[model samples]
Target: MPVSFLSAEQRSRYGVFNAVPDIAQLGAFFHLDADDRRRAMAANGARNRLGWSLQLGTARFLNCFLDDPEDVPAAVVDYVAEQLGLQAADLKGYGEKEARWAHQEQIRTGYGYTAFAGEQWFALACWLYKRAWTTNERPIVLFDLATHRLVEAKILLPGVTTLERLIAALRERVAARQHALMATAPSPNQAAVLENLVKVEEGRRVSRLDRLRKSPTDVSSTGLVKALDRHVELRGLGAAGWDLSAVPPGKIAALARFAHAARAQAVDELAGDRKLATLVAFAATMAPQSADEAIEVFDLAVGDLLRTSAFKATKERMRTLKDLDTAAIVLREVWLKIRSVAEIPDGGIRAALDEMDLAAIHAAADVIGDIAREPDEDFQEELLDRYATIRRFLPKLLKHLDFDAGAAETPGQGVRRGHEVLQALDFLKAIERRRTDIDPSEVPADLLSSAWHRRVFPKRGELAGTFNKSAYTVAAVERLRESLRRHEVFVPGLRKWGDPTAGLLKGAEWERARPRICDELNLSPEPGTDVERWAATLDFVPPARRRPVRRRRRPQRLGTPGQRRDRQGPPGAHRPGPPE
Candidate 1:
């Protein structure tokens, strides 16, 4: 059965010369070498020789001989005839003779080419099946690769329709295998859940799948929370827990891409196995992706809060600038009046203050009290004001996403670095568990930066020995954000925000590839050698030989454009005077 998957253009061009061969193509495909020339010369006539040579070159070039052997590009005939030392007209009576059919068989047997059948056909099918199973390559790409493989193996190209059907059949087989593998992953109850994803529930306009497919539209606490909720819903499906390790990642990704683009109706229209597989793929792929996005949205939301706070602080400071100036003037006047007294009298500073405008001094004191909190004093206080915003999503983010401190440096020691951030995360998790009864003393003081210490643990106040809960939460979140950005702390399953060292070559793999890697990088196998080389490059220039860069001065513009003085000549020799 032939498949109609191939486009008309592809069908038209396959196994035939559709265009004139370029110089390179002509040289590569049609040029006869010494052995080819000897064989061509052995033919009885010019026509037989030209025809035989054409079959040989065409077999190598197109990997198939045309049915109407004479139906080829004029340039091809000319190029071949020229190489055979015969006129182009010599190919006219070529195929009319019985020798033409005999020459094809001769070329097949002589050149070690085999027809596409039996063992060769089965072998090709198996190879195509493996390729189709492992990759999500488009049909056309697989077709091209298959064509090349046949050519290399000296197997004659089959009919275009035959090959297309084979590809279509193999792809369908792979899809069925994938669908069967995934369909068996979920139990009957879980399968019911997958079906429910596509069906629109009561009071809802879109299906659950549609809602889950939609990404967060806004970078806000609300949006982050919503994204986290979707992630939770996906994880709740138990798709992550399913043993899809047997399925290829590419196949999973392809299915997910299809599911994301396809409408709920279209997905529901698929056969049971396919529909189940698509949903499972969508859920599995989207689980980690959503977690990564939620974290990203949280990061952006925090940034937005910081920016909004800083802008407000700036605006407030700007509004009070005039009053601050007035207060400074009033205080300066009072100071000068007191300074005139020289020494403290019986009334001390009261004598100077009595002489001054007491009313103005009182107003200045009020202004000082109002403007006492400087804008740049502590930005964390402004961030603390939005603690409610962070609170909305931080606990959920910490609860759902699993963070790690990457691999341990020493094997068996089990000590992961970035312990500060990791400990802070653990503390936050504990706080989330404790909720209202979180103990302040249990807070990781070592994890807190110096700036956060006072906020977390206040001295000489009623708040002492009891750290501010909001402040501690915000500070921990801020540190987490920074650590995540630096990859000191990473979410386990996320790709974007996941462990930085996950892709590194480690263990025996590193040892095997290290020599080749060092040679490629033009470095010695020893780390000390590379370090010394880098150090030498840095100090390549000696202090005495290194010259200071001379600064270029801008040329001064004199008078108007039409009246500028020319300063191009030597300093005093020929300076142009100003225009008259």
Candidate 2:
């Protein structure tokens, strides 16, 4: 097929000679991702040609233009010049043949050339830039035609080198770096990896520099542009614990520009520490306070990481982090509920341990401990009251504390003791229900004598009307309910079975199927189940439907004409065919 923009009439078409105008015009094609600018720029002539046609004008190539004054951005032009070992002046405007001949010469000389360093070998690198910058895809790897073999580039491969050895080596390097970046937030362990990368990359950069130097590279735009990138990558790696302490701020800033991009080990390492804190605080403060604000920040942060090449976060990583964040938030809410009680302040102890900025209601756990130590009983009592306020959160708090793998498992005994609190609540509900349902003369005397009715819930004539005041009234009831809801594993002993349901008359099925039913419903049912609790779940069962009845019909066959004739004993006996 004829090239879209390449007139092909040869006069307008750029070939070998007088290809300068062609190069200049071609330069415009690179600037636009597509005619619509919705696509991306194409880095190379051939690649551009194919993409513009095959992928259509939307196949944008990365604008090799580095931010600078010159026509083809300094970085882009320099990248091109370095690729060919030619001066920018020589590349001012190139003909198809001139560019081709130059490219061939570059090929013969053990190198490939391009005006843009950002897209040295293939159009793909620039394409990747557009994808990430626009759509936020991962850093892609493709063949670099100018170099003749695979390069760290991302777009279309140069048609020149197919050397198996070089491809393997380049693949290994990219693979290893990519593998390292895939790991979750960097720790100190990433330090050595960073140092090792710098060591390996040094020689490669030197070789690149050597070529430009031998070709009499000036303190030109290309050199400056490359310096900028080196600075950025260096800082990014250092941030990942690669420690580019020797690098300058300019590069660090460049890397920062790309920081929101895909997870780069270097960028992540930088972000995981002080950088992360700063960004998080800043983002949180500025983001809208509505429920959607946190969601927006999450989106922005992830988007930034996507456009960058310093690291990569896989789909799985994102999913895991999402769950972690959810858990953290729920735990925080639980803390608040407990801390709200006046007599029992819950979060005081935890607040002290966290040492973080928390809501006013939350006091550090350590602070509570300190208050408990005061010689003043009144003050100590107040502190204990504050601690009691958080009684509701006690179970969740203990569970959270135990999440620390280093800590010994704390059996939720204190928390479990709270379960009867809920049973007492159930006991109350049952008393109320039975009170409304049955008469005083018919009341079961055993029900009044039950242990549960003896304390937390007092038995009033027929139904306990005067509320029982016990230490475990509301607090125990609420805590137990939450524990059951949270599915937290409690002490395995009888204490864990919760306050014995023996106090209540079991429902018909509770005597036999309670265990199996409780397991299915995630309720407590050793011998008796919480009938009231199960009431909530009964409606949750999917409604069943009966199938329609289909009856089988007996079949009847018509007799053959000969059989019919014999049976009728005449042709007149035969029936006429149906009228059309």
How many clashing residue pairs are found in candidate 1? 0
The lDDT per prediction is: 0.85, 0.34
Tens-digit lDDT string for candidate 2 (436-498): 443334322222223333333446455364443332232333343344434342322112222
Candidate achieving the largest lDDT: 1
Residue 26 Cα positional deviation in candidate 2, in Å, after optimal superposition: 23
lDDT of 1 by residue, 1-580 (tens): 1356888998999999888889999899889999989988888989999999998888988999888789888888999998877999989977678898888898999889999988887999999999988888888898999999999999999999889988999998889999999889987898999889999999999999999988887899989889899889888988767999999999999999999999999999997699999988998899888888888898898888878988877787788999999899989878776776756455467756677788888999989886866343657667788988888888788788888876545587645446677787787777665647556667776667666777787775687777677887888888778878888788887899998778889999999999999999888987798798889999898667768999999997777754443435445676657999
Q: Give TM-scores for every candidate, taking all chains together and pairing residue i with residue i.
A: 0.82, 0.19
After superposing candidate 1 on the true structure, give the runs of residues whose Cα lies further than 4 Å from its correct spot. 82-85, 326-370, 373-376, 407-418, 432-441, 447-449, 516-524, 528-580
